[model samples]
Target chain A: MARAGLNAERLTRAGADLADELGFDQVTLSALASRFEVRVASLYSHVRGSADLRARIALFALAELADRAADALAGRSGKDALAALANVYRDYARTHPGRYAATQLRLDPETAAASAGPRHAQLTRAILRGYDLTGTDQTHAVRLLGSVFHGYVSLELGGGFDHSAPDTEETWSRILDALDSLLRNWPD
Target chain B: MARAGLNAERLTRAGADLADELGFDQVTLSALASRFEVRVASLYSHVRGSADLRARIALFALAELADRAADALAGRSGKDALAALANVYRDYARTHPGRYAATQLRLDPETAAASAGPRHAQLTRAILRGYDLTGTDQTHAVRLLGSVFHGYVSLELGGGFDHSAPDTEETWSRILDALDSLLRNWPD
Candidate 1:
């Protein structure tokens, strides 16, 4: 029989926690099973295998990130909203490095389409609405924002900014300020 | 005697190739040994273990990327120089995803300081000179540029832009143009 309370959601949550603790790439069915004090075969009832576990973690992270972004951006606009949304990502990555890493895993198109990724793109567009861009320019702006947030956070977390001067926190605030200025006066 | 052709450099190169063929996370000493038609013990003569091999790949990638960026920036400045430098990174990442991923790996402080990463920072600073930034703002600009380049390329490689409209290429060029404009008129 299955473990008394085991199910996909429970297993997924545990997997995310494990990922946060052990690093995403280190997550495996065997590790989860060991953590749960169950045999590896028991995990098959909850997840197909390593790939499925990773996909679940990815989905979990995307949804969590989107929800946090939506919360932060609920009543804000312009640079206010932009900073709010950006912090949601950077803060989450700091607090949950492994889960944050999981979000970067490449999902198949079908799976990606069904995940909260669309919400992320939409949220980005919503923020850009205050910037007065339209058509392809707006799309380009959305991508720029995405790249900045993802790239800055990734580099920061990877110690790219650790050995530098002026402190990363100061630089982050300044970068955001610069981005706000860039978006406000976006070139035609 | 050791294999006639095997050494740290040779093994590191082969490891990078293995990383490209498989994935960075999948590159292993055993796998390298298997590919070379040699025993696992024989491989130890060169690399201490998986960690050492990965570190070598990271160093190799940093140096290689630095060399390319230096070449691209040799006779350029301002927006022209920025475009050249950015293209070098985006193109290198596209052609060498695995090696590019390895570049993102966090090296120990001593190793990172010794690697060609300093050259990358110098090159970035050189690009900023044409923008008229100085002191902290120049540092901030460098960080911003790093984030955007790293962030955009990473998202592109991870297929984040695959299902989007206007095509990634359009957004890329527009982003560069926007960056050029932003740098030219950076807020005080």
Candidate 2:
């Protein structure tokens, strides 16, 4: 029988928490069921399988991140918006490492299309307006900013910058400053 | 009997090739042995195991990529250096997909310390001289550039930008331009 007070939403939230604790790879139907004091078959009722659970967590993370970005960017522009957007991603990665990792997993085109990922892109594009870019240049800038932000956060999270050379936090701020400067004087 | 003219180097190279064709995760000892017309047991004599073989391939890729970056950046500075370095990575990812992906896999500290990854950081720092950044800011810019290039390329390779946008090539150029602009006009 399905466990009392156990539902898909509760299971998905627990799965996300477990993801932050163990990692995305370690999150499984069995684990979630155990956490809820239920059986594996019971989890199958809420989640199709392990993949479905992971995908749901990914969607949750993308939405949460987009929401934070939207909130951060509100009433902000120019460098303010840029830093806000960048920080939202970096913070999310740090706070929810497992969920952040899931965001990198490849999804089917249709699933990706339906994901909250587009909202992240839109928020970034909105921030670019402060720089006066239009058309293809703006699009290009948005793509670049997304790349650098995601790339930097991914590497940093992976401990790529664990060296003794100036702490990463110091470097992150400087990079934000440089990004602002670049947008102000984009090359011809 | 071992296949005529079969050896570890050949096996590693073969594995690397298979990686390019199938992806890093798909490369396996049984598959490599099967492809080489040898039993899996016989293949064990040449390499420690699947993990060992992958590690060697990762080192091979790091050295090879560092060499390419060195050649590309030879006597180049600023935008030229940035573009060439970035291109080496992108081109390598495109041409040697498996090996490139392996480069992202976690390496043992000893192996990583011996790897040519240091050369990459040095090259990036070299490009920074053309910009006005110094001390912590320079360090930050280095990290930022690494994040963007890697993040953008990984996402693109994973088909993150395959639809609903301009061509990836255009985006790549725009990113390099943005990086150069950002670096040249670094914030105070």
Q: Indicate which candidate wins on TM-score.
A: 1
User: What's the true lDDT of residue A64 in model 2?
Assistant: 84
All candidates' lDDT scores? 0.91, 0.84
Calculate candidate 2's fnat. 0.86
lDDT per residue as tens, model 2, A50-97: 888888888888888898999999999889889989999999999999
The candidate that achieves the highest DockQ relative to the unseen native structure: 1
* TM-score computed on alpha carbons, candidate 2: 0.90
Judged by DockQ cut-offs, the docking class of candidate 2 is: medium
Model 2 residue B120 lDDT?
81
Q: Which candidate wins on lDDT?
A: 1
